[model samples]
Target: MSIIEARSILILILTMPTLTRQGSFGSILSSWSDSNTRGPTISLHAAAKPLMRFMYHRQVLAFIKKNRDTPLSKPIMEIYSSYLAFKHLSPSTKTTILAELDVRIASRADANAVAESLLDYAANLLDSPDANVRISTWRVLAELAHHRSTATAVLAVQPYRRLVELLNHKNVEVLETAVCALAYLTQWPDGAQAAVSPEILSCLVKLLDSPNSGIRRWTCLILGDAAQHQATEMAVSGHLCIGLISLLSESDSEVVENATYALSWITYSSHGVEATLNADILDVIPALLKSPTPQVRRWTCRIIGHIALHKSRASILRLNPCSMLVSFLSDVNVQLRESAIYALSWLTQWPEGAQAAVTAKVLQYLPALLQYRKPHVTKWLRRMLKHLAQHEAMALAAFRTQLVPLVRLGTLVVSSMQGRYSALTKFLMWQTKARLWIPWRGEMGREVNDVFTGMFGGRKRRENGALIPRTS
Candidate 1:
């Protein structure tokens, strides 16, 4: 036999008495009368222990592949069902045996029959006395939760309360895994409904206050997925809006990123929007825009983008993200620049925002962004600037033809441009080289000041143009 096979055989020979529950000292003394017999037995065990240990992990990996084609074979099933599987086996070994019941069994002839038994076996492990067994059990549930068919079978057992109960566990790893298991379950409709139950959502929201940033991050992610269903959103929005929005300023970039994603979906539905508006979420946006992390900034852009897409300036104007969105038109990150202007695409759709766009100098920077190659950015840039020119006479007059294609002058604004041109045009014509006139290092604050003052009555524009503080 090969070396590994010979060593495994040696281990079985030396260890079977102990494994079979008869290797005690009294038993050994009674069983062996001759010193000659015990000498070789003791020496064989001494040699076998290390070899068996070295092969332990390899055996686990090989067992997975060995059972891959027959995961529910009679002997494999017996190993799981046998009392010795749980009683005598080390927790890690029990974990490996539990892992053997993963999604691979879905295609088996008896998959449906074995699924509940496997799920029941795993569900019981959540209360296992050993922490390692509990952690591995969490992994097994998360794996099962990842597939809808097995997830459906798993959920049918009502594992939500048991899993949610672990949200308060003292172990960081357990709490994080529990959140992930719930997050995976939320991928299905029934799973989401069950997860959003009042007790579970309350525990989830309370976790936002967790001292562990990672736990808070995972909680936010679960809420994000949970927010997709309308019933869940209605149930969660009021309770979760403030907690989630507060995390926007979290010091951890990962926590901030996850919090932003959660807030986006939470504020996505009409009910969510209404609840979010009452929560004063808009008050936090200007501060979040200044967040140093790019991912936080990125998802923050998406949160505002979602609002602007659904709600008009009736509420958005109160937040006045228009000027702030315009400021990033000159940012170093191209995607940030694109998000900046794309955010404006919704804001400029309204007359008030169109006017803000004019003050924010969308006209002056229009030429700078026109140089970009990303088609989407270029499209949003043209569309937003077009919205500005349509509403504000100053914006129309500021347009310099040398900067763009005439085709961008769509019918909405172009129809009015016929037989009527504004001061922006007058100033553009006067400056003729307006494109080459503006400097790149700083902003066009002065150029916009001159344009608006000369035509619109300038009291020197508002410096802190924040939308929320101005709300009555």
Candidate 2:
């Protein structure tokens, strides 16, 4: 028996446990490698891993490059070829190879060996019954385009057309790669965009709503990238933005985050943003503010801020669409709270009531924030203080009203600590100082004047009726 075959048998015997669990495939791989050292078996073993891996990856990609006709080796060769192509050089080298391949791809007769090999993978993959293999072929074809823009452009059309056919791919990897390829190809305005038929864009929008986060994220990024000028025209003509807005509350945080960022980009362009506004898709913004992930929350806030700044300036001026943003200030997550603060600050600069709505909502949280002991929490408080000072007219009055309660709580906590936890006492004292209260009682006395004045008008007396000096 050949060395590879014998090794394969040995591995199957000794590593049944590993093979059954698919843990490492190490024994199997080692067996195959051993078998490869033998003459004819070497060729067979070379194609074996590619074939097996292809069964799992389902795409003839950068694994094996043998050109056998069976379902087994073609996929293997496709991957091996890709591996060879990518390994030879960087993006620049790939670009150079692609540049050279373009002239040859123009006609069947003139096609160079490499270009034809790539096309062969593309065509064969499209014809394959396996959706994964077909999707893999599309990826290879798309990568081919990345090098030779000209050849890639020409090559991309058929693959692009073929991609639309695979929209129904059951495999998530296939669907994700296919749409991402389309997104990347269509980035250029020239030939790539021209190749995207109306049906393709429609299919892409459907994928945007796929329960799959990968699909949704890629689709949004693509649609958003394409939503410019003529690309915007094509996207709207195909009805894409509404679907994107629909994803604002997507269950996946990464999807929601990317979708929000993409939507923002799509809206920045005149026609793109106008189309979204005309669709009246503002209602989705508030819900995203409550996204469980901080990244999602931050992106959602930024997007809303962008929309309010540009297309929805009038809507923001009235604070009609920002009620959810005001509510976000009370979110348990500090990052989310700060995002809400930033969003409100930006909106408030334009709208009259925006600042008030934010301050009114945030003041209620001062009691809770005062009790928070984390260093990050203190940093957040400092940011809040800066914000309060910046919008002093709007936030200061509210901060002044709320500060007394917080200080009173802090004092109560400090007073009650009867040496039970010296560390806790030191931390609170540090917080009080970091929070800018050295002479806590003395500082509080002047600060409470505002709170007491609102309660006891004409309070010229300090209990004994001695005139209370205005400390401001």
User: Which pairs clash in the backbone of model 1?
Assistant: 397-424, 397-425, 398-424
TM-score of each: 0.60, 0.44
Per-residue CA lDDT of candidate 2, range 1-472, in tens? 8999999999889966543544554576588566565555447776775565545343332222233222323344354447334422233323333333343334333333444456644465466554544555555555554444345533534666566666767767777777767666656655346434677767876787688777778777666556544655545423766777777766677777777766666665555656666666566755665566776776666555656546466654553545766676667777666656556545654425436555357556556655656665554454444445444454445545665455345422444222212222232232333332221344444654555465335443322322342333
lDDT of 1: 0.66
Candidate 1 Cα misplacement greater than 4 A, ranges? 1-92, 98-131, 144-158, 309-320, 330-335, 363-386, 389-472
| lDDT (Cα, tens digit) per residue for candidate 1, span 43-89 | 77777766665566466667667767764765666546452135444
Residue 442 of model 2 has an lDDT of: 42
Poorest 10 consecutive residues by lDDT, candidate 2: 416-425
